[model samples]
Target chain A: MNLTIREALLAFRRAPLLSALSVTTIAFSLFVVGLFGLVAVNLQDALRGVAERVEIVAYLLPGTPIEPITLATKDIEAFPEVQSATYVSEDSALARARAELVEFRDVLQELERNPLPASIEVKLRPRFRDADHVNDVAERLRGFGFVDDVRFGRDWVEKLDRLRQVAAAVGLVVGAAFAVVAIIIIGTTIRMAVLQRSREIAIMRLVGATNGFIRRPFLLQGAIKGMLGGLVAIGLSYGAYTLINRWLIQASFFSNEQAVAIVGFGTLIGLFGSAASVGRHLRRV
Target chain B: MIKFTNVFKAFPKGGLALKDVSFHIAKGEFVFLTGHSGAGKSTVLKLVYADEPVTSGEVRVSGFNAADLRPRDVPMLRRRLGIVFQDFRLLEDRTAEENVAFALEVTGARRSSIAARVMRVLTQVGLAAKAQAYPRELSGGEQQRVAIARALVNEPSVLLADEPTGNLDERATRGVFQLLRDINASGTAVVMATHDLDLVRQAPYRVIELQEGALVYDSAVDESRDQAATP
Candidate 1:
């Protein structure tokens, strides 16, 4: 093991130009794959947030008693799939609308009375929060006698979920394609290393070196390139994401936690890709 | 000890390299395989090291059949025999010591023992002072000595040299042949292939001569020893 590492380091030092080319190739390919992965992750998060909010907004009859409203909220919350249900008064609804449109705050203050209705908004857990499930919950909420109307965006929620599925599928195909290309590039580099060191290989064979001893240094060299490429890839993609989302004020990108997971996942795949590539050619060496 | 009986070697390009050759080298014997270029001298040495498989018949080294040995065990077979090429085949980037240590390193020798063994072999080849010099920095004779050091470092039972002094001038050739004699004197059997008849005449060891892939003369054997394939 020690000799393998020492020889690999020596081989690495010998081929600065080739090593740089391999690292750059891997970094660029991984950057693309990682960026797409980041996109899918962030989109999935957004879709989940949207799906969880696929609630039935049950507007009560105006001037309804607080007792009935509180009872309905509690009942919805107890449902198996319901995440939470909260009752909002007319004034709080108006305030929320004003918060959403802060530029029109003065315009909203000109209103004589709150135009929004006091309602119970029922939110479902992400697993059960879909068009069909939200509509089923809406149907149950309509049974309340004091409920004036039950409304939910069933069609829009279904369309959003479909979009997310398509996006995720596309991301997977493209990411896998790039990953394969990256692996081939790494394989080619290892092949070059083998050819360049053919004399050394022959000498080692002549000196009774085992196949494992002859091949280990090349394998380690590939793995080291892979690991460095992954790090650079993570840095480039994450840097781009942060630049667009944080520096340029493009909100709603991947959260810090989501970013970390995606980067880690991308780096692992990169490492595996490089290892597999070199391993495939190692037999020839 | 090495033995080849009725060994036949066919090239990939469809010609016989060696046909029904048979010979045996006893322990500590120094034998010279002499022939013109393309006369199958190198093939016999390669067969002893199992570097090339016999087309048919059996060539055994250290009691292992050359053809039937498993691929995994080929290295183990080679570990008992050192090989030196005419070109030296040293890793040009490494120093003389590193080149020598490479043989022991491949055999998984301990680090503490590697330094001592490398020093001993380099000293044996009269190259201890040039241990730190790279191949490019060494003279042609010095480089060949390093190759010999590498081959000897493993303390193999037999040493196979294919034209060990092929590239050397007359003076360097004598030095290399003397070293081979010294190594053989220490009880390791030496099998050397050389077309240099002058060197062969100077050394009083047995000479096996080949003509057109058939054994023509073997100085150590009786007249009846020349029984190779007819065509």
Candidate 2:
């Protein structure tokens, strides 16, 4: 045990430049991949936040009975998908217009009567908040005898959903590619280590040391480099996130909690990636 | 003990290095394998350690069949024996004591036991004072002695030396020869390969001479038979 450690430390001392190169490569690759994942996670969160607020407004028909409008509100609210149904009377809608458009207030007073129609705003439950579910609910509400028009920004909701799916797919493909590149770089570093110590390995083999015994120091070196690289990558990622959030608020993405969770997951990836890289190359080395 | 029965060894490029050679070295015996440059002396040693497999015959060393042994088990077989080379294969980077301890380390020997065993072997080789000296700092004879100590550190039953004094002067050669004789006297079998007939005559115990990879002379049976007739 003591001799193995001594040998591993000697290997590090002898090849400082090679060890540094390997660690730097792992850190750089892991940082890029982690950054991509972080952005994707935050984007998904923001899109879901917007999507959850999606609700369709149903305007009542002119000359419709008051009892049916009240009954329609009760019916919409009873649906499993509807979170809430708030009735907006014609007078309230006109008042909201007058408050929102102060410059047009005088122009609105010139009119003899209010043209705004009574309506009900339907907010869907969280699980039913996606574009497809909202569109289905709006169509069902439009089937009511008193409903004249239904509006809920369906085009915008669909666009955001499409963007989310595309982002997820691209992230998966690119993430896999970068992982392979990182593993290859680690494997190359290990190969160089094996070549450098080929003489020592030959002597050990001649002295009846098994192949596993000869390959151990290199494996230990690779593992250490991997663990150190993962730590550096997480640190750099945290610093970048903090800098962006503090100065360039527009560029800020994830919450502090989300960043911590992502970095925790990324460290595991880095360790397993480097171990696999070393294992694949050990057979040939 | 090492035994080679009608063993044939052919290289990949074609041509036999050892052809139909047969011999046996008994326990506690010291024998010399004397031959010309390409007369298959080193190949015989390699075969004994299972470094090279037999082409068409049997090689049994310390009860293990060389040809039938698995590749993974070859190291275990080698661990039971000691081998020295013509170049005095010593790690130039390590000290004399480290070179000896390396043999024990590869087998996962204990750290506490290793120190005592290394010191014992260094003392036996008469290089106790040079334990901390590196190979580059040691003389050729001292380097060879370190190699011998490394071979003896494992306390193997059979010691195979391929021209241990190849790079030494007359005095150094005599010193190395005397060391081998002493090691053999301690009940360890020694098989040495050399072409120096004069050195072999000085301490004649048994001689197995090879010519074209064939066993041409074995002085054991011939000398005893002649002695019986003369009486």
Candidate 3:
């Protein structure tokens, strides 16, 4: 093992031009895989992050008593999928409306008492926050006589699902394309290495070196190129992602803290995954 | 020890290169394999190294059946013998020392051992000073010597030289032949194939002559001449 590595390193050092060409080919292929990986992860994260915030709001009838609203909120909280639930009194809803319309807050001192209806806001656990889960909870809320309406964004949920599907489909197509490119590039590199050292191989055979021994360095070269290429792609993609996140923050898409929160741990997994897959593909050569 | 029994070799397109050939070389005996250009001298050397399979009949070299040897075991067979090609097939990218060291490296020898053996063989071939020079930078003689050093590094029992001095001048040719003689005297059997009849005549050794893919003569020159002169 030590001798194989030593010889491979020596071979690598001696063939600087071939080494550089191989690594460059590896890096370019890795970059494409990493780029696709980034898009897929970010889209999935966006969809999942939104689902985690999905909540159901059930507005009560105008004449419903505060006690029933409180009781209904407690009932919803007891469901296995429900994480938490709270009653929003009519007065609190009116206050929120006034805050949202600060420019028109006066308007003859809001003319009459707060007109918004009392509502129950129920936060579902992550597993119960998808479209069907929310709809199921919505139907249960509607069963109550005092409940006037139960709503969450059905259209937005569908849009998010479509985005996830598109992301997955595109990820598969692009990932496969990048994978093919990576293999071809690495195979061609190793093939050239083989051609360049044909005399060496022939001599090794003449010296009674087994086929395994002669093929070892080429396999090692393939593995090393794969690993290095993956690392280069990861570094470049991560650097680009960080730069984009910074630009978004500076452009006021979100504050620095918010932007940090939006770029989650998934992106990191994605970068490492892209590297590992590319490395695996290249090792076979 | 090496032996061939009615061995025949026919190329796919070139027809029979060796007819029903039969010969044997005992251990610790240096023999010259010589014939004209179209003769089967090189094919006989190739059989010993198991480079070409016999079309029929048995070829046993160093106790291994050459005709039935596995492809994977061919390298192992080669490692036990040293073969010098007419072209001095040295890696152009490697220095003389590196070319020799490469052989040891492929055999999984320790680096320190490889270095020591390489240095020792280079000195033996009178190329220790040129150890750092690439094959392209060396003369034809030096390149062939490097090739010989590579072949010798493994300390193979049999040394097969196929027209090793084909590309050298008279001085260099004499040097290579002397080196082979010295190596043979040390008890490693040397079987050299060459068309140079003068070298064979000058060098006091058994000569095996081939004609039309068959052994036409296998005996000491003085014995053959005495028999012919008496008849």
Evaluate every candidate with DockQ and list the scores. Answer: 0.75, 0.62, 0.74
lDDT of model number 2:
0.81
Better of 1 and 2 by DockQ: 1
User: Candidate 1, residues B175-219: lDDT per residue as tens digits?
Assistant: 999999999999999999999989899978998999889998888
Worst 10 residues of 3 chain A by lDDT: A261-270
Q: What share of the true interface contacts does candidate 3 keep?
A: 0.92
Candidate 2 similarity to native, TM-score: 0.82
Residues B83-126, candidate 3, lDDT per residue (tens digit)? 99889999888899999998888877877678889999999999
Give per-model CA RMSD. 4.4, 4.2, 5.8
* lDDT per residue (tens digit) for residues A9-83 in model 1: 998777788878877877777777777767776777767766665667899888998997887788889999899
Choose 1 or 2, whichever is better by TM-score.
Answer: 1
Tell me the spans in candidate 3 whose CA falls farther than 4 Å from its real position. A45-53, A61-84, A103-114, A125-129, A144-146, A238-285, B36-40, B220-231
Tens digit per residue, CA lDDT, model 2, B1-231? 788889999987999999898888899999999999999999899888877678999999998988779867877887888888878888777899988998999999988899999999899989999999999999899999999999999899999999888898889999999999999999999999999887899996799998888888889867878999995
lDDT, residue A247, candidate 2: 88
Determine the C-alpha RMSD for candidate 3 after optimal superposition of all C-alphas: 5.8
Off by over 4 Å in 1: A45-53, A60-72, A88-118, A143-148, A245-285, B223-231
lDDT of model 1, residue A237:
83
B202 in model 1: Cα distance from truth in Å?
1.7
Q: What share of the true interface contacts does candidate 1 keep?
A: 0.78
What TM-score do all the candidates reach, one by one? 0.86, 0.82, 0.82
Task: Arrange candidates by DockQ, descending.
Answer: 1, 3, 2
